[model samples]
Target: MNLLRAAATVSSYTLLSRVTGLIRDVLIARAFGAGSITDAFWVAFRIPNLLRRLFAEGAFAQAFVPILGETKSTRTTEEARVLLDRVASLLTFVLIGVTLVGIIAAPLVVSAMGSGLRGADRASDFDAAVWMTRVMFPYITCMSLVAFASGVLNTWRHFAVPAITPVLLNLSMIAASIFLAPRLETPIYALAIGVVIGGVAQLAVQFAALARLGLKPRISFRLKTAWADPTVKRIMRQMLPATVGVSVAQLSLLINTNIATWLAPGSVTWLSFADRLMEFPTALLGAALSTVLLPSLSQAHAAGRKEDYSALLDWGLRLTLLLGLPAGLGLALMSEGLVSTLFHYGAFNAADVAQTRMAVIAYAVGLLGLLAVKILAPGFYARQDIRTPVKIALAVLVATQCLNLIFVPYLHHAGLALSIGLGACINALALLTGLRRRGVYVPSKGWGTFFMKLLVALAVMGTALAGANTFIDWLAMQQHAWLRVGLLLAMVSGAGVVYFGVLFTLGFRPNQFKKGGTPLV
Candidate 1:
């Protein structure tokens, strides 16, 4: 089908998830605020989240999707079905073990990620974190399975299910914050309970979607039989380097989390809230486009359609700049307003908004690069080439820590965000260069003009935001919550209109992005 439409569909669903997620965080901030307890919960949640990304979404999807696409194209229907069952069997077997280990070693895991939690004054926070970690540890099992189903469904061109299922988790958290947190002796435990419930809900929905397509795996417990399958072995082998690549990113997160723990009491929570805001554009544009592109790119490779392959990458990059730049400019210029509008409420106060705004601005600096990496890395993943990106990621990881040393001393937690953003830009550049040198991706014509037009649009958007920032007192308007929300929405929407209105005048058409043939599944 039309790739742009697929991306738009995924983006639309993702926006719903993001909206619900923001509400979840808003409820959280109102109830709990950015404090030691919230930091504890965020850190504890990171453990299972780390495992899910490492084993399923990050490494596993990168490795599994390409091979599954290849299998669907080259093998019979029965062969593909068998491949799915065996892969599922092997994955479930592995993640179960990881989950158990995580539960039993919850204390060590929490300490490793956030050592500062162990101080005598923070002993309660440390214990609470461990308790939550154990409760949420099993979340990875359900989420990993969900990720498997998502990759399978996306490969089958069922993008809406995977994109929207995340909303279940957000809703689960929101419900717990409202209904469960108040009744509990330890309210934070409600979030952990919510995490498990959400994971299971998401897993259930994903599997149901798979069943609708009759593509659900017939999971087997026979590890030997699954391992003996050549396709399963290939996925595991591909995961080797893919895991390393993903690990580099996770490692940075682990380091940053630990650093945040040591910086200030609310640093982790502030950064987390800021991160949720940044994810709006990221999930909408970067993730949506990449999800649609990866399968199509794999199809192009399988069919030996070189021109189609390059054009798809070009189209994704153009869309990245066209939309992502305006988003970044809005975030950086009006960060205080955005943060205050969304988060300044009951428990969350002016100081928290100020701190969160700093991180948002830092993150916005690298939004384009972050979006670019999402688009470019899939270029290698679709070709079943994970090593180049892994090597580049290792270097970026090193550069990030070095930048952290230089910036954190001055900028505090925001420095951690700044370093990560800068590192992502470096990583994207290196990936683009590698793709060019290897002749895997060639830049299409009009790139120069494309960027020039995007720059002009971004300048206009930035100017509008600067004007809003000066005239609007976001922190002072906290008492007028609804009015602040209305004003923020109007300013962002008006600026977005000015941005895209310029692009339209400069001749950027939706038709240019309407490339890619019917998806091959």
Candidate 2:
């Protein structure tokens, strides 16, 4: 597959999902506002969401995809099918058990996640969160299966299906918030119901695609058969360390959620809104690039093509810088305006916008690092070397909590965002250092010149954005949604024009961006 083409396919679909997700969030903010109800919903939603990432997208995908790709490339078709079935059987059994337990232990989980809710004043929100948690628990089981199917398709180079599956999630939530919430006595339960529906829908779409690819998994409970499979054992081995590496990052976020619970009523909601905005660029670029790169990297490693593996990593990093820097800086610069324009209306007041913007800027400060983790972690995972990343993630987690202790006292919820960014930067740096120390990756030539050009381009874009910012009254944006959106679009377009124009003027060409899957000299 053409790496650039595949990334674009994934990015385009992901962009659509984020756009709809933004709409869903906008409705949510209008209906619920940034308070106890919204906070409860976010916390409840996060329990299943975080577990889905930990089990499905993060460690599970990392472990499954490499092995799946290798099996497809190096083994017989019958053998690969058997491996897939056995893995599916084991995952299905485990996830079902986890889902049942998670539902049963919702109160304990909620209490552990947000102990601040234990206060008498917050008991209502605590009970609400626990109920919502049970409602959303089954989502983990559905998405775990979806993730496995996604791995199968990604190994088969069916990028569009998995990329597009997230749209169902955004649509389900949007429909729930707008259409279902108002009808319900407790509106937030609609969102939880939508979560379960979306998970099932996501799983169904991927399952259909897998059937079309003739890779439909045969489900079973033959533990002896599964344990007898060497490939399954290898995946389990990789999953152990990969889980720690993945979970530490996610656990840090849970820690932030825990910390946010004690701050103020709107703290959880504010951080969540800012995080949604960050996910826009992150899903479009970071996730899309990582999704496409992992299988390719795995393919290279499986074939013992050391040089190709290095070049793919080099190519991914260069692309990371090319896109990530401008995105992070622009987001930090435009946080206030962007938040107000997109989200400030109805129950989401100016104060909410202000708080969310601060978090946005804080999170954007480490946007590059966040994006880098997506690209870099795959480098380690593709090689089935999970210990290095787990150690690095653990160290970063510790330092981040330390920063959290220091910054939260001063920065409030925004400090949590900042610490997350700091942890991401540390994580990315450690991954890079490990890659270099192992001599598995070497930077390509012209990196210095490339970065210099990037700096110049970024400066030009910043200047353009600053000039555009002068004409808009941010306070007035809350009253005129269309006007705000129009102005934001124009400013973003002009900034992009200036940034890319400068790069073009400095001898960068479209062809340069398209040149991937080539060995670096």
Candidate 3:
């Protein structure tokens, strides 16, 4: 696959999903705001989301794809089909058992995560968390299947359907929030219902797409067949290390959630909101590049095309840095204005906006680190080497947990954001350094020059935006809040124009960067 072409396709769909998600979040802020219910809902929501990233997107895809891609490349179609069926059967069995356990332990899980909520005035407050967790527990089962289908579709070179599936999930939640939220006694329940419906819908969408490609998976009990398959054994081998790596990250997040429980009633919600905001850019640029790069790199490595593999890795890194750096700077500089413009309305008040803005700024500081991990991790995964990342991830997890312990008492929700950012930087550095030691990554002479130019352009853009924001604030003092929003939007647009224009004039071809050229921006 053409790496640039795949990234564009996935990025476009991911961009759409992020936009719809923003709308959903805006509506959620309007309805629930930052309070006990929002906290309860977010805590419940994070359980599935953390699991989604851990088991489905992170470990499963990282482990399954290389094996699947190799199978598709080396074996006959019939042989690959049999392998898929066996693996699917085994996955179904495991996920069923996991989901049952999750449902049974929902209350204990919620209580452990949200011990801070016990101080609430009403006894029902604790029950809300339990209810929401149960409602959303089945989501894990559905989405795990969806993730399996997505891995299969990705191997078949049908990227659009898998990339677009998340859009359906976001839209389902949006619809639920709009139509069902007001009618439900507790708005959290509406969001929970949306999670279940969305997960099922996501699975259905992928199945239909697979059927169109004549690759439908049959339901079967073939655990013995899967366990005996050599390919399955190899996948399991890869999965064990990758699971450790993903679990380290997930455990760090769980630690953050636990720390947030002691901060304030809405501390968890504030952290969640900030994370969603940062994820908008991360998902669009970082995730899009990583998702597209993995299969391409895996193919190149499998074929022993070292140059192509290296080129793709370099391209992914440059694109991630170019896109991620500016976004991080912009968010950090304009956190307050951006947060106020987007969310300071309805049930979300000025105080909530202020708190979330601080969290966003803190998260912004680590955006490059986050994107770096996204870019560099694929190199390891594509080489079918998962243990290195697992070791690095463990170190980063310990660092993050230590930071959370030290910072949360002083910085509140923002402390969690800071810890995550610091952890990402550590993880990225470890991955890059490991790749260098293994001779997988050799920085070209042009790297320093490219980075220097990109830094110059970023400085110019940041300065221009900061100035523009000051002017906008001065003008907004004499205008309505809506007018202030309009002015702020104009200021942001102007900043982008100045930023890209300067880079282009400085001999940077944004298009070439997208196509894997040196990062000049």
- Local distance difference test, per candidate? 0.92, 0.90, 0.83
- How big is the positional error of residue 212 in model 1, measured in Å on the Cα after superposition? 1.3
Q: Compared to the true structure, candidate 1 yields what TM-score?
A: 0.98
After superposing candidate 1, which stretches have Cα over 4 Å from the reference? Answer: 516-521
Candidate 2 residues 295-381, lDDT tens each? 898989988998888888888899889989999989988888889888888899989999999999999998999999999989998
Compared with the true structure, what per-residue lDDT tens digits does model 3 show for residues 256-293?
A: 78778777778888888788889878888898887777
Using lDDT as the measure, what is the rank order of every candidate, best first?
1, 2, 3
Runs in model 3 deviating more than 4 A are 119-122, 474-485, 517-521
Task: Kindly report the root-mean-square deviation of model 2 from the true structure over all alpha carbons.
Answer: 1.4
Better of 1 and 3 by TM-score: 1
Model 2: which residue pairs collide? Answer: none
lDDT of 3: 0.83
Candidate 3's error at 230, in angstroms? 1.4
lDDT of 2 at 322: 90
Model 1 residue 242 lDDT? 98
